[model samples]
Target: MEVVNRYLETQASMCFSILYDRYAGKIFGKCLVLLKDEALAQDATQEIFTKIFLNLSGFGEKAKFSTWVYSITYNFCIDFLRRRKKMQSLFDDDTEVERLKDVADDVADEELMEMETAHLRAVLDRLPADDRTVLLMKYQDDMSIKDIASMLDKTESAIKMKLKRAKEKAYRFKQEMFTEAVL
Candidate 1:
């Protein structure tokens, strides 16, 4: 924040460079995960930072600086995917209401977190983009439900439901992969 405040106060390029050095790699990794293509991730990372630079003056203190940056990153990736796929909606919505009714079992966060790294990655890869995205936002990014809700422009309960379904799907994918491997 000192960096942001300094940049805001002096409009100095050096302060911005410090910010870029700190966040660029993390942002790029996130882009690569969401975009699923090295070239497109590279392009998206650059474009996202450009948007950040241009919008620096508009940074409000409502959210943490990291949260604000990630919001921009995630939103940019989602919008890119939407345009590329020509889809009106990027997330699974109420159409799955019937599927969501069953709650006989829930996947514990520790179960997902404790998986071998490669297995975890494989399971995540098998999930639909929307499911993987919500899981990343919740577990990997440590984003709060309120924060995610705001980011996705959904109600808090809606984000919770989405997150629950994502975890369930991830767990199912993990089970199927390992079961098939053993067979």
Candidate 2:
């Protein structure tokens, strides 16, 4: 924090570079999971870093720097998806179900389990950006509900509800996949 303050005060590129070195990988990982494309994630990571640098002066001390950075990352990715109109709902086509079924029938039990995990990932990707973000923040990043609420600027209860719904949605998708496999 002191270093960040100094960087803000001095406008030193080195300080900014240091910050980037410390956080770029984590930011890229978040972008990759949210964007679900390596190229898009890389581009998004660059854009996110730019936004963070430009907005450094506006950062309040209410949240940790990492939290603030992650908030920015999430907002950028969600807005990007919105602008592109690319948020597809899960199980939107019979072709996808057929594809999964075809793969499920040919695989051994171990491979089938792996495929199931992959299918769940695809389902997660298909969820609404906000829902995916909430799930990742809670489970992947292991964020506390309070911190998530603060980061999202929502009430704790609202965050809780969102998390619950996201989990339920994931479960439903998994069940649907399994049912499809069985049939």
Candidate 3:
């Protein structure tokens, strides 16, 4: 936070660069996991950083920097998906959904804990963007529930409920995949 404060005070490129260096990869990975498209993720990463850079002055020190950054990332990705869905509705048919079903059926999770990283990401991708965000924040970023509630602007109980539902959905998806594989 001292570095962040210095960056805010100095408006130095080096300070901003240091912040970017510390967070860009994690932000990009989160975008990729949520967007499920490398090209879109790359674009989204750039957009997220731009948001972070522009909004740095507004940061109130209420949450960890990483949590703040991730909140932006998650919000941007969800908005992007919503926009994409609206656009898709104008042109897309059921083929995309059918293709996703095929992909899901081909991937099985004997045990989620034992699943490979790629498989885990695939399963995560199958979840709703909000659910995926919760899981990522909890497990991938190891953020606490209180921090998540703050980031999401939700009550702690709401965050907990969301997390529980996300986990249950992931487990159900895994079981469905496993059953598909068996058949």
Over 111-130, each residue of candidate 3 has an lDDT whose tens digit, in order, gives 45576676677679787777
Q: What local lDDT does model 3 show for residue 110?
A: 40
Write model 2 residue lDDT over 1-183, tens digit each, in one string.
Answer: 877898989988889888999989999988988888999999999999999988998999888888888889987887788778775432122132212332223223233234465776777766666778887787666789998888777889888866765665565566676767888
Clashes of each: 0, 0, 0
Model 1 is weakest, by summed lDDT over 10 consecutive residues, at 94-103
Q: Pick the candidate with the highest TM-score.
A: 1
RMSD of each: 2.3, 7.8, 6.7
* Candidate 3, backbone clash total: 0
TM-score of each: 0.89, 0.70, 0.76
lDDT of 1 by residue, 69-176 (tens): 999999998888888883456664746443434446787999899999889888876766777778888888899999898899889998888888888877777777
Candidate 1 backbone collisions, by pair: none
- TM for candidate 3 is 0.76
